[model samples]
Target: MSRVRLLFLSLVFLVAGSVQADVVNKNVDTAVDISTQLVKIAHKVTVENVGKTPVKSLIFGVPAHIKERLSFISAKVGEHQLRLSETKVDNQEGGFWKLELRSDITAGRTLPLSIDLVLGRGLIPHPSQITQKEKQLVLFEGNAYYFSPYLTEKQTLTVNLGTSSVESFARVQPVSQSDTKITYGPYEKVAPFKEERLNIHYENNSPFLTITKLERVIEVSHWGNIAVEETIDMEHQGATLKGPFSRYEYQRETQSGIASVKSFRTALPASAVDVYYRDDIGNISTSHMRVLSDSVELELRPRFPLFGGWKTHYTLGYNVPSYEYLFNQGDQFVLKMRLMDHVVDDMYVEELTTKIILPEGCHSIELTAPYSVKRLKDTLHQTYLDTKGRPVVSVSKSNLVENHIDDFELRYTFAKVLMFQEPLLVIFAFFALFLLVIIYVRLDFSITDEEENSRVEREQKDK
Candidate 1:
């Protein structure tokens, strides 16, 4: 053959070989339903060489979103199993590739790829076992898709929801297709599997309240006392009342059925004394207190049952004796106290102002917080004969969830001399003023003598 003919033949062979090497057998299995909180996706890819010559390697690509929830469960190619490693290919979010078989593929060979993925709404994993009695499970209804040019074949997706029968209205739609069709369970009446209920009904009796404004002032007086005041604007997020609520009906229902809305139960530290819970107008008489040696528990029964979207504001104050939170470390004084407790739900702390009043001569004011703070502002607050003024720290956090409460800590330091400086200044100032008044009176002429002399002088002048 001529050199030109040989070159053309070589080119044709190379093109054919590349096409054969790129061919892959792909299988995708996907399961999704509202009954389960999550969707499971499994993919298997197999590569086989039908050409006469052996190919060196094969490259497999997966969708970006697919990799987020989907993990490589296992993979195998021929007798040698392939180990899968993830690598970013492009700047695109979900761009990744799996490299297999770096060497040439022998004639009539096959390589397999297997991967298992668990996909869901967010990074937080859905609860595995949801109890029906808890009434906390929410069905997750969403769509998922798989795309690959290598796998031109379409596979049917299967979804099963254990014992609970699939709702006849449940619909499934393919990503590429706009039309959706309702389908029944593939299997007939089978044994109900012990699966967590996707829908649950439970007693949610806890009142959901938010503390719109919280002002905690720690005033260190020369006289030993730390005062803590909390103002809370609480609201109820329970089932609303339809039409008018009848007292007779309510009482009957209370006797027969369980209450859906949560009630208020506030627990204070054992050392907490002089606890009080009052509403905007005045004290709520329904509240009761139980004090034990270890801790104090206050039961605050609102005047009315809090339903969904109903709001009530209340103020609570308690004074902790000086020795409880204030401690003497060598010459320095340390004041430590618990700010708030967990258990409180929907706690939207719009503004938290904390004033730490140190003794008059105390120095070196430092503040630290244990919890992650959204925003914080600090300033000096002078009040009540304070020479250098007290340091006030303000923290503001928005859209705060419940879990963040456990991680919060606030710490600060101040000089110990203020412990005595404030008291001495107040006492000496009052005493000095009293003595000055007495001395001025004694130096002046007597009141009676002055009055008599003035009268006699007036008589002589008149004569």
Candidate 2:
């Protein structure tokens, strides 16, 4: 792998060096935490412009083999998100990303950057096969240092393992090492296109969970509620259970770590209420809910404990006061919410879709996200009393990570005149119904009792 194989397992970041240093990478601190199913790597760095020219962009590289598992590649300058572009990796199977710094970095100015990456293939069973009775020891391999096209004045790498039963480690000269962690030091003036090898085997038997698909729909009702619904397709991608699982044996074997999913929890806004959870089969009863300080927590249990190579599908929904996500900017309506605010930890999402349904008569709908979307569609959706249908905006993407939780802003022109349209239509409908009933009751459609009696008497006299 070239210097920057930090993402997709094959991110060949090849940046040509300049004779004179125009941009200086002062310090880079990379932390790789392997405690969860998905690997979380965070890079905090300080960059400065040393030369007379301004720097426009920087290249980031990632691994190639597991590109499908990688997601939520994002950067931040303080609280603001930095814009980036996707690029094809040269001679590498991974992904290459270029972050554009629109402002010219003047000679002496400095910039602080926070980069976060998620690796879907972080922890896999090393042998790729494990028996029911044996302890799982998985091999984790990666570059010892951050691969960069540019030289760094200082750099560091820290590896955090899941448990202490780690052995058969292959390592280079690291300043410090431990049973559950390793550190490679504060190296000085590093050359580009250099690779450091890391191969270690550790024992971890947690359920390797991945969400194959997630669909979240947000509906805004000016009348009262902000309704949110989510449909999920979840899978346990960990080591397959070899034989028929014995519950009695599982209960008896407490010491051995087994990979299975018993339950999961999620957080909702503080004001959320009327929570509902269900699956394709029916309502899931093995769930609980409660209210915390500023949020509601929902603990959900699947129909059964999920073993490796098994899957479950479910849906959940709740409602909150509209005042929470909607605000008024004079005549315009501004709605703010996350694409996906709550999810399981170490999550690997294969696909994510977010749909926002606005009021019936909203016009000039403007929707924005922090990053680009794989697909976006604007259409009309018919609902109760909506004559013209509500405006629907759907955003979909693939290869999602939990950290993709960014606030999405939607602005639309909502006239006060249209706010009462549905209510008025409903009231008119009821009045029409009552009028029909009154008219039917008063109209003389048949002969009265006296007429019937006179007709009977005439028929008897004629006989």
Candidate 3:
């Protein structure tokens, strides 16, 4: 071979090698602030080919466990497609992708890709089937993907690639970790816990699931036997339960299941006398109630087995004996009670509402709450011939979760005499008007002396 030809062939081989080489890069951004229950995440990826030959197709992979928490997936550049493929060794599912160039060209170009993350407990639907018959109250929802209770806050989330050339950019920090608490970043770090951290795998079987906490407070009045009710709702925000679930599998798991992403139990206040729990279709027979002298506890089991992505609703009510709440405290009647229990340990409030009802004759009302209230309004509610209608106060707050419950308080006072003062005022006003008309008639002088004489003469002549 000629020397020139040999040199040209060697050069061509070297160029071809560069176009076929594989390159991968990754970057991650995360924000954690429990005060709002929202966590934001962004991920960027880049891939290139360094080999000499033009590559027709290339596949990029992601963790198999991430399928459940991914709210959405799309490519930043190139007409690429994502698919779920089974790994041959474990038969477990993994994310697969295929990318093709619009037009084949020389080797040295890079492909940039991006994916966004909105992670938390899961999604909760509005006007949910669970609360169709009752009012809807939502307290907090978090957005974080792949939350592992077992993971120490210090352990950084690390994404791995087989090749060393693949680069990554990630920013992670600790929030809180202790015996009674476990939290993540955008905040200060805390100590570790003594109890085992719970672990939840990313299983994409459903669309949404919610974690809710409800509390109902009833105040008893001796004279009127009044009952006051309040409720709070909180949900888990992250991934949802996907696909149609198998009843057989659900039942089997119920008997021996140790881990669940959707089941929760609620405890009622001790003073509750009669309790009822139901969803859209009506009464759910699965619930059981136990009444103790000091308090009552009700166990509620949803009609359909609640799993991820599925929803259920329940309403609870109990009667209070009269005179328990109507008594006067230093010439002013005081009404107070705690409305809810078991707010998630780490959850904060996005919104809160409190309604207070005052008895008749109660006036000149004064009120206060332990937490900050964004808005307050007073309205009249007429019931049972209340002459001096009852006062109803409504309060609303935002960015609140479970930890702020202890700071909640509501107080109000009204005049005791106004209860009957309004009725008495109405009655006296009517009688006063009647007496004034009678007095005016008696004071009028109708006939003068001359007019009377003329009338008498006319009468005598006619006779």
Candidate 4:
């Protein structure tokens, strides 16, 4: 038997022996935040096991219609986060996920669970196009009841629109509106797989900027520097501008373009230095930077105001001290950095690709991401004084929100002596050049000694 076959059999048995449980949601309270472009949902669930056996894990689900809008989801018990994996439940087709609890719950026992979800592209512009003076209104459609596999004994939902200027909302029974918040049902004994469309149409004049594409490159140097550069392509995904833009009218009215984006703030590390923000034209001097105690805040303003459907592209870069993110103890080095940093508040990123370039002569590379990301094939990148080229690890993800901002760790092995490789190469090149010069001066290149003596005689005569 080959080792490969043996390992395959081991994995098959390991999965077959896993535990399954039957649990019910005793009570659920959900809150939806639609103040900005992104939709944030938080659920506080009280779960109880109804089966005779112990329940080691629980399954959570999202409706198939809106599954593509979900960008991030997490379940926590107390302060500890549980591990969730995508799985398929029998006779069901949706975004089904299973999470293992910290400890198993016996029959008739209860446990409290906290689940949070960040959804992108959830709020869509109602009219899809508007003039400069009109307020931006969006429509949000979601489930009225908690979408769960098991029967929910009691559940309630609250929608916070963060604005009192409302248009219309779904009139589900036992629903009330108070200021910017809408409350729905303390309904009882909800059946499994039940869904009721909840719609809210309201005014949201917030900036609806979205990053269509982002390419982040992090280059590491053993000489105590780590350089990061991000190329961003941004688009205003809100209502499209209907008429021609009028700069003079926009300047006259203070609230001419309420939904138009003029500027946004970006945060960097406290130790970040030599920061630059530029575009294809050249440096943009309209930006401002303020150094805070915990971070460096940069206010980026494009050349023109970003109206609906307008687009802009820029490149932002900075350098941080290697000691802050890179750590090494006797050869093995670990680099901890953010997978995706903050682009703007409540920002939605359509596509994100991150690349990390390690120093030359590094080997035994390992990567640990906070969430699942599609890892691309590793390649080599050659730069100045690079002999064998640096190893570049690339990973990509889509539909990312602000909640996805977290650290990813990379580990690699590099001998301390390899740090001197570039300096040594420089020294050897100079030494070889000097040796060649010495040999060239001493060599008698004349075809004959008579020709050499005649050249010397001509030089003396001229003098």
Candidate 5:
């Protein structure tokens, strides 16, 4: 009986293998943008089911070398987006994402997909260290083919260097180099899990500002105001500083610190008011703000220039009307706000924790995030006039990119009468104090009554 059961299981595994092998990549065209600190890759893939069975999903893979740096990945079919989930790929060693297609691909049918991937810490500083006056050079190592689980029939890879000064790149045959772009291949018939070293050495001077940690707090008020504050710890993740720093040379030389970061513009909501930026030392006046039609551009300059490997910390806060983000129906309330906002262009946040402090007396709270996050334990926050304290909802996520700038919905139940609780408490306290004052002044505190004492004094004087 044991031998018969083993044979049946083996047959089932073989049949599943054949079904998975039916899906193949008809063509994959990849475009890699290496213009900034982040590597952005877009793949236009056409897949086909060659066997008699319909294909229900497709598998995408990243090389093991770059797997840990993967920050964001998304897929779309025309205007609609597809769902993706992480799964284990048997016999493979790398990161894999399984994308579920809207409709199954029938035998001999093809389906097109658009996949975008963003990777942080992808580029390497070739020299690893640089002086204040030296221009920065970096190296990019990647695969020449679209790393996937299925066999690809035809594919081409394009790399945009963003600068005409090209040091060198990989040549994997049928390669052509234009001014700032490199074309790799129209390669034919590639096997699964194949990797060819594609390296590019070039000059990139983009700001490598990385927010090491961010704590965002959103305080909701039932009195028509919402307050937001963000505490940010930032560091320059570019090349290391080579030698002693000279403030004189940096100020005198026009070409000094090309790779150093002087300032970066942060975009806030147009409705943001009373915006302020400060560090531990106090208000930082080196910044400027310009209110645009749609956003308020705040140019933040630290106390000093940020050299490679340098670090800084600061706090930014602003206020917005509650009506813009808070909505209510009877006793139920909802708050829709961005989980994270634009810190900078192509920003990378290593750790992010967002806390939403709802009004007191709120209950049955729930949160809806655009992506998966680690929901922390609910806590109570005590502020002025709070009786039982306000409910605080916190969620954390790591390895975040600017793609995470999306809205989160927080729903809770709040009684309409609770809005007047604080005001009524204040009013009654004042009224009770005035009543005590009236009794204290009008009544005699001594052992005798004032009117009776006056009458006895007059009788004694007349006698």
Candidate 6:
């Protein structure tokens, strides 16, 4: 073949691929929440199924570099969880995750999906550093479209910023910049395998919060109470202070609740009581609990303000009536509760450990999570009067996003007979101990025989 002919053929093939790659993005309602630590994005997208056979899966491309730090929290079609797998887009080749539908979408039908995306290390500080008093500026970059191997038709992008004062942003022809948000393109028939870059530098003085480690313990008691406790080691992942922090300046800013993590708040189930907050230095007195009609709001202040690159560790706990979370279905007991419940805002957890401790003598256990779990193990836990010890189900995961929180279903069987086993054993043990004491006192040795004979004579005369 001639060189000119070969080049012309390659060009023709590329044009054909681009022309066929477009997918109708019927409508996309995108929400970006950048007010808190992590930048959370959600898309309620409706797309047309173009293939002749039923389309069972969708291939969506993501920035491969940030894919590791990104949390693909939930992808739902209607009300069911969508299964995801790594695959290539057949029509347009790219690295993408295939979202498998629970039910196939017939050709020429529309499939609506809700996807949750969290960027873990989303905010990059602009100056590569900052001073203690200087406000933090974050540089964030993202593709205008939801990086799909297929080109989008009539897609719109809406972005939310951490601060209303957006210092700088990249300008695109079809994009409009607002105070705290930017919206780009409802363009029709966009070519495939293309990227329209979007960049923003915004004023976000908030502490980029991350939980280094989180340990949550859920204790299920057949005795009418469910207790939950979570230990958290939180760190400010924002720009680090160049020098030693100025206490005076930080106090002024922190006292005003500006650019400092002096306190944090989260909600608890209204029935939750016996609330407690503590750190390594014992109980934190600067915490408050407000009981609302629907839920209890807990606000806890750490020992000191958390600045950039600073860390603090604490634990919060509460108790709920067992009837609220535990349900009895014939011979089996089921527990429905949030795995870690809630942490601070826009939270990113590096490592999280959740342990469900069932009552003593529980066996035949089953554990299920709505989200992905890294490691799961079953073991025996020993406590007071625990003869055979209680059963424990421990599950650990990493890179947890706040909105990714979901309920964990745990089902187990606890025999009614085992409920009384511990009490009976305790009674038997005490009774045997009492008998041994009596037997020891009754034994006679040497001089004790005279006293026994005298007592016997007195008893016989009285009779």
* Whole-model lDDT values for every prediction: 0.47, 0.76, 0.41, 0.89, 0.89, 0.75
Candidate that beats the other on TM-score, 3 or 4, i.e. the better one? 4
Candidate 4 Cα errors over 4 Å, as ranges: 1-22, 432-463
Q: Indicate whether candidate 2 or candidate 4 has the larger TM-score.
A: 4
Best-to-worst ranking by TM-score = 5, 4, 2, 6, 1, 3
Residue-level lDDT tens digits of model 6 in 267-382: 88899989999888899899888999998988878888777778998888989999988998776999999987777766788899999999987778888888778656688889
lDDT per residue for candidate 5 within 228-319, as digits (tens), equals 99999999888988998889999999889989998999999999999999999999999999999999999999999998899999999999
- Cα lDDT of model 4 by residue, 342-383, tens digit: 989999999999999999989999999999999999999998
Q: Which ten residues in a row have the lowest lDDT in candidate 4?
A: 12-21
> What TM-score does model 5 achieve against the real structure?
0.91
Each prediction's TM-score against the native? 0.51, 0.85, 0.43, 0.89, 0.91, 0.85
Give the 10-residue window scoring lowest on summed lDDT in candidate 6.
Answer: 13-22
Q: What TM-score does model 3 achieve against the real structure?
A: 0.43
Clashing pairs in 5: none
Q: Write the per-residue lDDT of candidate 1 for residues 223-334, one digit (tens) a residue.
A: 6777767777665433333345445654665432122243566666677677777887788778778887876777777666554455667777777777777766665555
For every candidate in turn, the CA RMSD to the true structure comes to 14.1, 5.1, 20.0, 8.5, 6.1, 6.4
lDDT of 2 by residue, 1-463 (tens): 3222222121223333422235556798988888777788899988766656777777666655435556667788888878877875445456668787756667777788899888877677765655556566677777676665555667888888767787666656655777777788877665544566678788877668788999999999988799999999999887766767676766678743366778887888889888899998888889989999988988889987777778999999989899878998766998999888676766778889999999888888888786778547688899888888998999998776777777988989989888889889999999999999999999989889999999999999999
Model 2 lowest lDDT segment of ten: 3-12
Shift of residue 184 alpha carbon in model 6, Å: 2.2
Residue 380 in candidate 2, Cα distance off native in Å: 2.2
What residue runs in model 6 are displaced by over 4 Å at the alpha carbon? 1-23, 26-31, 49-54, 77-81, 89-95, 102-109, 253-257, 440-463
**Residue 9's C-alpha lDDT in candidate 2?**
24
CA displacement after TM-score superposition, residue 235 of candidate 1 (Å): 1.2
